[model samples]
Target chain A: MARTAGSHAETTGPKVRAVALRLFARYGYAAVSMRQIAAEVGVQAGALYNYTPDKQGLLMSLMQGHMHDILEARQATSSEGDAVQQLEAFVKFHIGFHLARPEALFVSYMELRNLEPQNFARIEALRRDYENELEGILARGAAEGVFTLDDPKISTLAIISMLNGVVNWFRPDGRLGLGDVEQIYWGMVRRAVGAAE
Target chain B: MARTAGSHAETTGPKVRAVALRLFARYGYAAVSMRQIAAEVGVQAGALYNYTPDKQGLLMSLMQGHMHDILEARQATSSEGDAVQQLEAFVKFHIGFHLARPEALFVSYMELRNLEPQNFARIEALRRDYENELEGILARGAAEGVFTLDDPKISTLAIISMLNGVVNWFRPDGRLGLGDVEQIYWGMVRRAVGAAE
Candidate 1:
């Protein structure tokens, strides 16, 4: 049965998304069932239709929504500055933002293979938008002779890849704090592009 | 029915592993059933047990085998040299070896979470050993004043992460050939650690 429009949905909707993200991250999208998601969300299997039309819809919504959140947060955190300053901000922002939402980051990358063709394309475009943000910085830096780069496109991917690795091993209670991680990664990102001395 | 020792088992064994790797890479380990793997290998589900005891065994074998291959290949491809030369060899060797086995790399990283606890620990230890190889080089370079590194361990993770990103997007027929990619990545890897001019 479809849910009636009221406070119930407003509260239950976010709950459904939260449950789906966790389930997808823990078990790959292909292995998870809508019944499992509904059970986790404390709703009947039939009631899940009120939240998401199908499993594919849930996967796509979670992924696309994650991209939107990333872009929105990135836009808010990023500063208006020169290429070098902007690149540094990006390194710190990428690590902190991703580290805080490991499940989101993990599911987004891991489930891309499961998205339908059109959904995959949409998510890919959003991802490209994010990558372009950094590429723009590298391009400006290269043109201004402030950085040496053979290909800004490749550098953008390399830098992101390097930064993404932080989530895999970083621990707050471990030897290094988030600040130490940010500083170290910022140094590597800056040097990787051959920023001016 | 289980097959007795024969040439059939010898030939079917490798076929089973290859199919399992492909299926696991396509649909994650948890999602891909043993029946699916056996079907892909042109054998009955029961025949799969003759080769591997169960799904968990198959996953562990594939993962552990991949790590062993990485270590064995690293030892063979790595050349005896000073810090700078060895780092170059590592970057090139890593990219070449990984790119050639995209399916194996994909399944190894993605299905790691699904491995049983004991299996996960064994695979992680092997992974750390491989990481120690690069960390040792960075340590040497830092000591010799050939490189500047705030943390050798973090540098190892960063460099591997950066290089690992290559496998996700690289194509043999893409605009850049393998040699061009090796040179480009090596340059970034070198500068990432503050390698001297």
Candidate 2:
């Protein structure tokens, strides 16, 4: 529940995690010191100890938060639909999630090494859980003869790879709008899975 | 040249660039110092200047070199073939290029902002050239009625996005061999284009 932005118990855990995420993204995690985070939050260095034991814990909390949101977002967005519908919902939610939260993207990919081995593997497994969700969807689609694929697992990775890529090249002010981006990704996903428009 | 481990430079350049790239990747471009690079390369700080005018220039050169290789790989591998063949070649080439040379991958994504505005745009344009090549292939495939794509440009980005993602999860000792990974990627690309298996 506690995070590393500042030790001030008055600050909410999520708020502290947000601050630390932005800082870690801008400045690499190792480059930023605990004192700097305390300064940013207007709290005493000793105060941050109340929230997080160390910088690594803060990173773990931040990553886990993001991974968990992704899981919840997919679960929340998905409905009683077939494979394509579920996959579409997942893709839309994924792009929307990362685009809306660049700080989370930074923390998940950039600060993984900062997590202790046990914590790092834990979050990594959670992240893989999202992948598994997609894989299951692909398998169902293929099994139902709605989607065609030689190998469902590899196909799922390819789809996720392309979908996850939106965060790297997409810009809010860029030439394309969000809806178009979603449609574009869906179109590609369909093609990748041998589904027709 | 005396570039550091995993530098993109050929033999023609000086050693400073190599040392700097290796150091920057290890310690981050912002965290590394010109003196440290000089020390690594067994040269005095003053002598390092004779090779690169400044740290920014060194960073830009590395970026430029990476972009050049990417563009070159796109050109070299994507020639004298039909759209489908060219695209398959392109995808496999992309995986091979990136995996075989992590240096380019590290610079293109990790050390992007270190470039000066003018230099940065130059590198970006090279990347765009590669993207355009993919777009052209997809568009051609669609036009030939061999492929189905709603948006060639976005599909190109989507596929490349998936391809670039190999960096985050790929491990040589893993169960899947590199060839298997390439086959998986190619299969996805083919399906995504709506090409027959």
Using lDDT, give the best candidate's number. 1
DockQ, 0 to 1 scale, candidate 1: 0.72
Candidate 1: tens digits of C-alpha lDDT, residues B134-195: 99999999999998788999999999999989988898899998888898899999888888
Candidate 2 on A1-197: residue-level lDDT in tens? 44555544565455566678888887777777788887787666776677898878888878887898888877787466988888888778777788899778866876665567899899989978988988888899899998878777677667776876677778899998889888888777877777766
**Cα DockQ of the candidate 2 complex:** 0.47
Each predicted complex: what DockQ?
0.72, 0.47
Error of 2 at A2 (Å): 22
Give the CA lDDT, 0 to 100, for residue A83 in model 1. 90
Looking at model 1, give its docking quality level. Answer: medium
Q: Which portions of model 1 miss their true places by more than 4 Å?
A: A1-7, B1-7
lDDT of 1 by residue, A1-197 (tens): 45545539888889999988999888778877888988887778787788888889988999988899999999898488889999999889899998888889889888888888899999999999999999999999999999988888888899988998888888778999889999999988888889864
Clashing pairs for model 1 are none
Which portion of correct inter-chain contacts appears in model 2? Answer: 0.66
Candidate with maximal TM-score: 1
- Compared with the true structure, the alpha-carbon lDDT of candidate 2 equals 0.77
Number of the top-ranking candidate, with DockQ as the measure: 1
